[model samples]
Target chain A: DQQVKQNSPSLSVQEGRISILNCDYTNSMFDYFLWYKKYPAEGPTFLISISSIKDKNEDGRFTVFLNKSAKHLSLHIVPSQPGDSAVYFCAASDFINTGTASKLTFGTGTRLQVTL
Target chain B: DAGITQSPRHKVTETGTPVTLRCHQTENHRYMYWYRQDPGHGLRLLPYSYGVKDTDKGEVSDGYSVSRSKTEDFLLTLESATSSQTSVYFCAISDDRELLGDEQFFGPGTRLTVL
Candidate 1:
């Protein structure tokens, strides 16, 4: 079963606009969530993350908001740039429930396209 | 890529043949991982090693085996390859010096095709 789900396959947004990627998880045991951005032919890179205890975390232009009750989290990129266009994968880790704290369950991923 | 290099970036092999992929890291991060990426599936863990001679199975470790004889190298072997095993594989490393050691750096990727 897919514990993490990214329902949207792709998203298109204009430059200087906001791009939001959504992810949902079925397991409430997941306490830490992260977002990774991947380009074609390249491996994914860490973007942002948030703990279940906090509702939001921001780093520069990228922000991650978590809602523990809904089992949902979103990555928001404000004033999206062309460089931001890539496949975004949301990953969750059940640090509190598992010994392998580094183990992560990833969603299918959502491709974000920034238009000129 | 965090000093991680996966050799044999692309390979093609016939079914039932054995194939091995290598992941080498210069950083000596202490934690290594293998994952496969497919069209519908984002990325699934295959096997991982915490240190030399210390390894564990992951989510999708059925047809794969891994060995980490040294701190800098992790090898994944697919004995009797199957067409279903053809996919892009990635190797990641993590430094668990802190409690939140969830950040993992990935290698470029290795594309394998089983004919």
Candidate 2:
């Protein structure tokens, strides 16, 4: 069963525009959500995250909004740049301890392409 | 990233051969995990380790075995290679601070091809 889902496989947007990527989850037990960006042949890099307690978190040009009732979360990058072109994955975890087998469930990933 | 390293960055092996991938971390974090990435499957966890000699299976652990002899090293072994096992594998490390909500840092990943 896919607990986390990123229905969009790919997205294209022009530079200076806002790029929005969406994710949905089935399990309400997940208290932590994260976004990671990956380039070709490279490991994923942590981008942004939101706790279950909050509805939105922002850092610089990136923002994450979570809606607990909808079981959905989204990442928005304002004034998207070409460097923002990469695959974005949404992950959810249930635990806070590292030694407790806290496994992260990832979405299928959405590839965002930004053109000038 | 988190001083995590995955050795044998690229490999090509034939079916039925035994293969092992190594993940080493200098961060000394308590948690380590192995994941495989595919086209439509995203990243699937194969195994994870909490401490030395303490390990557990993830969502997909079939045809694979893992060992954590020390805090710094985690090894994943494919008992018998198969074409379906050809995918990029990633190792990640994270601390125990759950309340502060730290994120997992990933290694560069190793690409394996089973012919």
* Interface Cα root-mean-square deviation for all models: 2.2, 2.1
lDDT of 1 by residue, B7-112 (tens): 8999999999999999999987878899999988999989888778988888998989999999999999999999999999999988662743688889999999
Please give, for residues B18-64, the per-residue lDDT of candidate 2 as tens digits.
Answer: 99999999988888889999999999999888888988878899999
* Candidate 1 chain B: 10-residue stretch with minimal lDDT: B94-103
- Candidate 2 residue A57 Cα shift, in angstroms, is 0.3
Clashes of 2: 1
Instruction: Point out where model 1 deviates above 4 Å.
Output: A96-101, B97-100
The TM-score of predicted model 2 comes to: 0.97
Could you say which candidate leads in TM-score? 2
Q: For candidate 2 chain B, which ten residues in a row score worst on lDDT?
A: B94-103
| Candidate 1 residue-wise lDDT at B113 | 97
Candidate 2 docking DockQ: 0.67
